[model samples]
Target: MAWYATPGGLSSLSAPQLAAARRSYDLWSSGNPGLASKYSFDSYVEYAQQRHAESVAETAEQEED
Candidate 1:
């Protein structure tokens, strides 16, 4: 099934929109945006947290080997 967002939110995106979204995510994630952009502050934080957790879990698994 196709992905979706909120009713009045970004439920869908075009090619350019997807590219811009990716660029926006990459930019805000590098500690440069400083949580200033209201568009993706929370999402970016959640993405970073998920990445951190995955990295931590991977490291733990590696150390156990």
Candidate 2:
């Protein structure tokens, strides 16, 4: 299953929360507007949280299986 489809992954984020996260990422990226550099601090943090949540959900599913 996709990361977003995983248990606890989709439910972990509400519609408003997802919109806010997207807005934050967009704002951060737009501020720099350089391809040479990577994501900003806020973007990195958001990505890390998303990755961590997905990983945790995947691990839980694996353990269940």
- What are the TM-scores, per candidate, against the unseen true structure? 0.42, 0.44
In candidate 1, clashing pairs total 0
Clashing residue pairs found in predicted model 2: none
lDDT of 2 by residue, 1-65 (tens): 33233234334666765666566566766776783166654444456577877888899999999
The TM-score of candidate 1 is: 0.42
Please name the candidate that would achieve the greatest TM-score relative to the true structure. Answer: 2
For candidate 1, lDDT tens digit of each residue in 1-65? 11112111233445565555567677765756565455474465345445666777899999999
lDDT of each: 0.52, 0.58
Instruction: Give the clashing pairs for model 1.
Output: none
Which 10 consecutive residues of model 1 have the lowest summed lDDT?
1-10
